[model samples]
Target: KMFACEHEGVTPDILVLGKGMTGGYLPLSATITTEEIYGAFLGEYEEFKTFYHGHSYAGNPIACAAARGSLEAFRNNDTLEALKEKVAYFEEELKEFEGLPHVGNVRSKGLMAGIELVVDKESKDPYAPETAVGWKVAEHAMEDEVLLRPLGNVVVLMPPLGIPMDDLKKLVRVTYESIRRATEGKPHNGNP
Candidate 1:
């Protein structure tokens, strides 16, 4: 969303925010409508024109209170501005993997990043789906204490907003080492 707003210059008419809005402290999501769209839903109550959507815990008092506190923390801490700096450093730190074999593309947008693995760099040939190459890297990364989520051959990194630089660097190092070990001919445990 930040990438779309800042880099792509796009503004959404309606936005859906979820768990991350409360920093995962509660399960909640909100569908925010633009003024124009919201106005469309507005009419005389007698007209029977209304949008009714609710969940089991839709307006739970505890959850709503926590979410408000979370939003205020973000505003007070200047989280967004601080995130830009961390994202820049995180992207730069991962440059260590650019020269590694099978390291195809390093992509980052705001605090999210993905390292795409490939069989042939020039041709950008991805590994076989059944090979589970990304999973291997993620499994190996856990050995180095950095958890990653992989989509096919793309290993994704999305650290928390408050993670320190040293920790982020550690994540980068672990990720690089994991990919390096995963792609090498010699196996880490000598199994294959």
Candidate 2:
């Protein structure tokens, strides 16, 4: 999609950018808004309409340069164009999770995806937080040299845009194995 908002044909009043903005090489964030919204903070001091948002880490020259270079790499390498094939392949690979016994949902956009694990597929009952089922899957994945982060019972998989196809395949394969090992082998009720 051209923009996340554009996917739904909507324009948000405010937008925030972080994470991949600097290609994960630095810490940075940005706030973007429509001109009309900016005008709201343009009034006189007595009006008390000013927006006084600031942070000590708001701007760093090195981070800005990294962001610029990251953007240049995107353009120079046609990264987005190249991502189409990878995203399609990723979606296909993710289908392997849907048939897994404990996976209740597999949702994705672009290269980012989450596999939601459930205690019961029919009821979609989530495992208790103490179970740390997500972490269990991650631990298994780590053994295979694939790092993943889990949000509760949902294991998130977000590979780099420039990740090679072979690595992407391994990521999915390892994650699939990890999920199986964590959910299918033994009873994990209230345990890791």
State which candidate has the highest TM-score: 2
Sequence-dependent TM-score of model 2? 0.90
Candidate 2 per-residue lDDT, tens place, 1-192, comes to: 646777678999998888687899998888889999999888888999988886677798999899999889888989889899999999998998999999999999899998999999899999999999999999988877889999999999989898988898889888888899899984333222
Maximum-lDDT candidate: 2
Q: Which stretches of candidate 1 lie over 4 Å from their true place?
A: 1-3, 185-192
Q: Give the distance in Å from residue 129's predicted Cα in candidate 1 to where it truly belongs.
A: 1.6
lDDT scores for all predictions? 0.81, 0.88
RMSD of 2: 4.2
Residue 190 of model 2: what lDDT?
Answer: 26
* Cα TM-score per model: 0.87, 0.90
- Candidate 2 has an lDDT of 0.88
